[model samples]
Target: MKNLKKYAKAIILLTVIILLVCFSFYKISKSRSSQFFGGLTSHVNTEEKIIALTFDDAPTEYTNEILEILDDKNVKATFFVVGKNFEKYPLEGEAIIENGHEIGNHSYSHQRCIFKSQTFIESEIEKTNTLIHDHGYKGEITFRPPNGKKLFGLPYYLNKNNIKTIMWDVEPDTYVSGDADAIVKYTVENTKPGSIILLHPLNGTAGEADREALPKIIDELKAGGYSFVTVSQLLKYEN
Candidate 1:
C-alpha cells in the first residue's frame, strides 16, 4: 500500500507546517515591542533629555509614599494598574489620579497576553480600562500587557481600537535584585534620553525596592536634567 504510506507522509508534513506557523505567531505576539498588526510604541527614539517613569501593578499601600516623593520632587509619572488590582485597591488607584499622575491599564487580571483567545484579550484590556475609568482616571489610557507580552489577538484589538502598547527601555529593578538602593543606582547609571523606565512597586515583596528607589530616582534624574513624561508624551517627542 504505497499510496497509503504517501498519504500518511502528507499528513505528517502538513502537521509540521501548521506547528511551525503557530510557533512563529506566538513568538511575534510575545515580542516586547513588535506586532503583526497596528502600532507598537516601546521606547522613543530621541536625543532630548526627557524620560518616562512608568510603574506596573497595583496602587498598593505604598502609593502614598511614592506620590509624596514625586510631589516633593515636582515630577509627574505614569502608573499602569491592573483591573483586578484596582478592584482590590480602589483608593490607591484613585490616589494615583488625585496626586496628579497619568494612569494606564495593565490588564484585568495581570495575566500573560500570549496564547489566549480574542475574547480573553478583549476582556483583559477593556475591563481594566473600564475599571480605571471608574476610578476617575480620565486621561488617555495607554496599555502595558503583563510582562510585556502580546500576540496577534491582543495587538490586533489594540491597533484597531487605537490603544498604544507601552514598554520600557530601562528596568534596573527587573534585571538586578529588587532592592531600593540597588535599583536606584541602576536607574541613575542607565537612564538615557527618551528612556521609558518601568518599575513594579507592588504585586509582592520584590517590589519594595521600587518603593525605596522611587524618591532617589526622582532626585537623581532631576539633578541630571531629565524630565519625566508619560509614555504617550514620550512618544510625541520621538526622533
Candidate 2:
C-alpha cells in the first residue's frame, strides 16, 4: 500500500509538471510582449511622439485605396505582405514600394507557423523575403507571423535569419470589426508614444472598418502631435 501511494504521488507530480510546461508554452506562443527567442518588438522604447502604422496581408483590391489615403495624408507606413498576394498583385506590391512605404514579410501561405517543421518555416520566410526583394523594396525586411502565432520553430528561423518579429501595441479594428467609429475611438484612445498599430486594410470586405478608420486614426493621432514612421524607422528609436 505504501508503494502504491508513492506511485500515486509520483504520477501526480509528473502530471503537474506536464501541465505547467504546456501552460508555459501556450503563454509564450501568444505573447505579444515577450518571446523565447530574439528580437520580438511590440512597441519601441521612446519618449517621442512617433508611431508606426502596419497593414497586414497586403496587395489586395483595396491596395490603391489605402495607398491613396496614405498619399493624401503624406504618411509613410509599413506593409507586412504575404508572398502569395504579393505575387498575385505584383503591381500593387510595387506601388507600395514605389510610394516609399516599408515592406515586411507576412509569410507565404499565411499558415499559423506554430509547431511547423523547420523546412516549412524556412520556406515560408525565405520565399516571402525573396518576393519582397523582387518587388523593388530595397529595405530591411521584418516579419510578422500570420495570426501572431509562433513557437519554437518560427522564432528560431526568424532569429537565425536576423529578422525582427513585429507585433502591435494597438489593434482597434480587431476588436471593433465593421465599426469604423469604434476603431477610430479605440485607436485614438490607446495610442501612445512609439506605438506600433496593426490594421488589416488589405483584406477584402472584412477590412472595410480598418480602411475607413485609417484616415480618422491618422488625423486624430496627428492632431495629438503624433507622427507616423515605418517599423524600421520606429526601431531606430529603440534603446
Candidate 3:
C-alpha cells in the first residue's frame, strides 16, 4: 500500500512539473517584449514624439486604398506581409515598394513558430525575404512573426540571419476588434512617444475597423504632436 501511495505521489509531481514547463513555454512564445534568443524590439525608448505604424498580413487588392490614404496623409508606415500573399499579388507588393514604405516578413505560411523545425523556420523567412526583394523592396527587411508568436527556432534563425524581430507596444484594434471608434479612442489614448502601433487593415474582419481608424488615429495623433515613421526609421531614433 505504501509503495502504491509513493508511486501516486511521484506521478502527481511529474504531472505538475510538466504543466509548469508547458506554461512557461506558452508565456515565452506569446511575450511581446522578450525572447529566449536574439533581439526583440516592441517599442523604442526616446523622448521624440515619433511612432511607427505597422500593418500585418497581405498586400491584397485593397492595398491601393491604404496606399492612397498614406499618400494623402504623407505618412510612411511599415508592412509585414506574408510571402504567399506578396507573390500572389506582386503588383500590390510593388505598389508598396513604389510608395517608399518599409516591408517586413510575416512568414510564408503564417504558422506558429514554436516547436517548429529549424529547416522549416529558415524556409519560411528566407522565402518571404526573396519575395520581398522580388517585389522591388530595396530596404532592410525586418521580421514580425505571424500573430506575434515565436519561441525557439524562429528567434534563433532570425538571430543567425541578423534580422530584427519587430513587435508592437500599441495595439488598439486588437483590443476592440470590429469597432473603429473604439480603436481610434484606444490608440489616441494609449500611444506614447516612440511607440510602435500594430494595425491590420489588410485581412480579416478587424481590417475594416482598422482601416477606418487609421485616418482618425493619424489625425488625432498629429493633433497630439505625434509624427509617424516607418519601423526602421523609428528604430533609428531608439537610444
**Strongest candidate by TM-score:** 3
Where does the lowest 10-residue lDDT sum fall in candidate 1?
25-34
Model 3 C-alpha lDDT per residue in residues 39-124, reported as the tens digit of each score: 89999999999999999996887799999999999999999999989878899999999999999999998998888999999999
Rank all candidate structures by their TM-score, best first, as comma-separated numbers. 3, 2, 1
Candidate 1: regions farther than 4 A off: 1-27
Ranking by lDDT: 2, 3, 1
Better of 1 and 2 by TM-score: 2
Per-residue CA lDDT of model 2 for 101-197, tens digit only, reads 9999999999999989999999999998998887677899999999999989998888987999999999987688899999999999999998999
Tens digits of per-residue lDDT, candidate 1, 75-101, equal 888988888878878888888899889
TM-score (C-alpha, index-matched) for candidate 3: 0.98
Candidate 1 lDDT score at position 36: 78
| Candidate 1 to truth, TM | 0.87
Clashes per prediction? 2, 0, 0
